[model samples]
Target: MAKKKVILFIVEGPTDETSLSTVLNRIFSSSTVKFQVVHGDILTRDFTSTSKIITAVWDLVKGFMGNIYHKNDICRIVHLTDTDGVFVPDKAIIEDKTIRNNAHPYYTETQIRTPKPDSIRERNRRKRNNMGKLQSCRHIAGIPYSMYYFSLNLEHVLHGKTNLSDWDKVHCAEAFDLKYGDDPNGFIIFMQKSSFSVCNDYCASWDFIKVGLNSLNRFSNFGIELPAVSQTR
Candidate 1:
């Protein structure tokens, strides 16, 4: 009568969480599945050492598992990290002793390659450039939607035209929120819609956060109790 738990681990960031959660929910919609997606503060400290990040993820996973595994139920953890500009592997490196390592290689990665200057002034300049492109297009309406599309357009411009496929557009809109500036809902939607949100060919990083929140919504609608990563905690 119990549900199977699928744990999703992510680095700190509302945008990232949204994308992963959305995809997981979309993938596992059956009644037999239960998910526990935790957004961690892996990037809080310097992630220069990959070992530290992996260790932190391991600790979080072990702590999340209570005394439920003995009841013939299994828990799986899927870790999603951002590659940024660095070239990390697409596969997840899991370190659980008992479990077959990376049993389900949902170990995914995203890139954040922004060639523009990191300084506030330069960053603003880059944002302005992207915004201008979005404003020129009329595919969507409303200021909020316009802003959202503009921001994404900027990403596309920086990375080159990504051939915004139908599915990609649908997910992208859901992934990036124009209303909430850095809100994660839109990104989560992107993740749920697209198999992969952010990759080398394209940089749709917002989808992860959007997708994750979507999962939470589905779980709540089904009356399923799940743990949330509270900011205060």
Candidate 2:
């Protein structure tokens, strides 16, 4: 029998893998669904720039292949990213001197509060520009590529909460897996019907999140990429 082509998912952290890997595997049973946990937001990473984003993604794909799979063995790359309120205006970023930690930035629907507002602003500027470049990127190193967003962050879109500690993130992902692991169709339905699900059009969904404070709001374009049940098989 021929090996199944891989459908690679590039995600920020392990919790994302924990939450969706099994369900996505079940949904895309015809292909091998694999998760590449990038450990941090590549879009906002200090070493990444708009010019290097595409190559960075391609490098990730190659890293995953790692002599085990050839480039042709991969069918597509689906990148799932947190919006992190990156598209919000500068005024929406408030420097709260009371925030003594200086490293932890907190998000609200209207603003992100932190002691290091300038750092956050710079991160946001880079993220916004990099994401804009990524949005138009249809392929990386000859492999089909598409990107999706969870506004504010994954925990917000998936669990209606944010600022979760690592333990909380794992707990929530496990709980989410328990709910959807055996019901891929149900997962699809939930993605489609959720209040956070953006419109079905891909471009429109990205546009919606970039407008005003919508990036800080609960929204996802992932549902737009979820394959229909019949198509999955």
lDDT scores in order: 0.31, 0.89
- Candidate 2, residues 21-43, lDDT tens digits: the string is 98999988888999999999888
* Native RMSD of candidate 1 (Å): 19.5
Runs of candidate 1 with Cα error greater than 4 angstroms are 30-53, 63-74, 88-233
All candidates: TM-score: 0.33, 0.96
Q: Kindly list the per-residue Cα lDDT of model 1 for residues 105-194, writing each as its tens digit.
A: 121123222222133223233333332333233322111111121112222312232334446644554543333234333333432333
Cα RMSD of predicted structure 2:
1.3
Scored by lDDT, the top model is 2
- Please give me the total number of clashing residue pairs in predicted model 1: 31
Instruction: Report residue 68 deviation for candidate 1 (angstroms).
Output: 8.3
